[model samples]
Target: MSGDPLERIAAALERLAPGPAAAPDWDAASAFVWDAHPDALHPVPEVSRVPLGLLVGIDRQRDTLLANTRRFAEGLPANNALLWGARGMGKSSLVKAVHAELEATGLKLVELQREDIGTVGRLLALLRGAPHRFVLYCDDLSFSHDDAAYKSLKAVLDGGATGRPANVVFYATSNRRHLMPRDMIENERGSAINPAEAVEEKVSLSDRFGLWLGFHACDQDGYLAMIRGYCAAHGLDVDDAALRAEAIEWQATRGARSGRVAWQFFTDLAGRHGVRI
Candidate 1:
């Protein structure tokens, strides 16, 4: 018997439409990276993160984030958080570290890349009914001029119809406090028919995050503290005078002082001492 061509064509088209992703095996891994293509959560068996104590110079931020996360892990109310400020000041590091610190409480970390943000609604749907608590993290998140993705993000964060899942919290790190370039903000101000409205529309996205933690460029003392913390954590022993002198030289050559630089210097120091960190 000859089959109808249209029937076969319809079957092929149905196959082309993406199917619902498999329910994630939350117990398989402590961390995941959301994949939007086929709408799946890829397990991350090993998450690279520093010990919470090894993170120095941002003690105040550390305490605040830890408290918020702890409250959420315990099934209490907690607001979405935005970690904004200086580059390499440990904003992203803190998110991972805090997740690691709270892993014992069954908190899970899902790193959603900025590119996959458009799929946030789907991701939330996948996570909504799960027994686990999740931290949806995005690193170096920012919106450039002509980028419309932020609108979707703003909507999801604002908890439009579906609302954010009670078991899930969001934590994002951005170099820009407003998550937009200064030039972009200025351009909107210069060209918009309603200047104040235009500016507010772009800037208000950050308001969705109830908590804003600002990370600043570390001072010399803060940087030194980071270096020493790394040394102590890794069992690297060096004379204080020599270590400080070399650290100063490293900062001078790099023309910056931050936890990242201190860590880089520590790596070199460890290498020189024939120790692995």
Candidate 2:
């Protein structure tokens, strides 16, 4: 209190500011969410996810991602993965399910938000020499006009000078295969003096991911299988014929047939029966 007013004000400001984040307790949890502001990894003890067996549709996608993840976990050479395709077809779910399925092998999943792409380099540096292998996940990843954050992400994935750590691999889920709208790439093509190179630079971001597993929309049988799987797992006790009829009616009302819709219908059915899933 006796100090000069300016000095005292500065001291107060410093105290009010956040301190450097604590080093992550990597062993504390199987999953983590990377917080870039304070620069810390937050543990996720209970991940919100469905069991891999319950995922129902997209068997091929499920297998491909699992294989690549397994290779990475075993310290074998593995490609960064891009899970792209129809919405709610389990792109993000597959990533989480795969991590959960393989967590016993010391594979850790770290979710980095799309907005935090610029800070990925810092996160990679932290994970570079760690004993454990990490799958850096970004769900719903995409880029818009003039957003340069993707450059840092590209550098980290492609491994600029140091190269990506053998212990770390990146996985992302996106509705767009290129993580950019077709129009966005076309716009670059329309404006650039050299259209091919301009477009190549933008679309090549996806190329960094060696595994481009696409999850397409499921068919009627696929959708029904999803609903039946959930019903059986949760003990809904509904007859097969009745279940199919209700599920079909539900999809008709909603005008869609995907895993998400199946789950939504199951939720309603459970609610009516007073069964908590």
Candidate 3:
């Protein structure tokens, strides 16, 4: 039988680019990111993270997260955590720090972007057979009213028969507690035939996460402490009195205090003082 001309062209393209089956070995990865285009996992050997000690004014949250992460790494029972609250309060930083701290103990961190939640199942599937423990880190993970991706996440998180691979834990940071805005849930309640049930269905997704760590805006004292901590860690030797004065002024100008704001102030301080931070 004669081969079709289209078939010959398709064969040529296949020879050039091939299918996902010809892709690199995913199991070789100590870490992975989910690629949704072809529903596959991309191998990543090294993760980008900040040191654990530099995250400040969150000792309670740090201790809780450290303990939970340690337990998971030790092969004990642990909860999937949701770190939520104020913007730039080190919610995402804490996640990366914890991952870095635990990596020496054989833990691996895989960062999945906010837009990749729907491909979570494919990522989970890829990790199920890997030897190292996995922390699925998603930063800034809130959803809008029209976004239906959370349903897919609900399935991957708890409903899959594979059921969140025993070697994996989820650590997500968000500006909202339930990963949805109050208005979204309120609108569902106002418009649905059965208000309570409709709200419950939309709200219950967060209930799947067993641990909730809330991050609030830092007080001036706490914020100053963080600035000093970063300054000290990075060897920026500004005098204590001047450091405090500048940190306070920086916060005042920003009209709010947070880890992010503190870091920004420190960066500017280091630049002006001709020191590294």
Model 1: CA > 4 A from native: 1-12
Model 3, residue 117: distance off in Å is 0.9
Tell me the lDDT of model 2 at 101.
95
Write the residue-wise lDDT of candidate 1 on 250-272 in tens digits: 99999999888988999899999
For model 3, the stretches where C-alpha displacement exceeds 4 angstroms are: 1-32, 38-48
Please tell me which predicted candidate would have the highest lDDT against the true structure.
Answer: 1
Candidate 3 structure, TM-score to reference: 0.87
When summed lDDT is taken over every stretch of 10 residues in candidate 2, the lowest stretch is: 16-25
- Candidate 2 per-residue C-alpha lDDT over 1-277 given as tens digits, one digit per residue, 9 for 90 to 100: 4879999899999998866556588899989999988788999999999899999878888898899889889989899999998988888888999998998998999999999999888888888867789999999999998898888987667747777877889999999999988998988899999999989977889998899998888898999899888888988788889989999999999888788888899999999989899
CA lDDT for candidate 1: 0.90
Better of 1 and 2 by lDDT: 1
Better of 2 and 3 by lDDT: 2
Least accurate stretch of 10 residues (summed lDDT) in model 1? 154-163
Model 3 clash number: 0
TM-score of each model, in listed order: 0.94, 0.91, 0.87
Candidates in descending TM-score order: 1, 2, 3
**Candidate 3 lowest-lDDT run of ten:** 18-27
Q: For model 2, what is the alpha-carbon lDDT of residue 61?
A: 85
Ranking according to lDDT, highest score first: 1, 2, 3
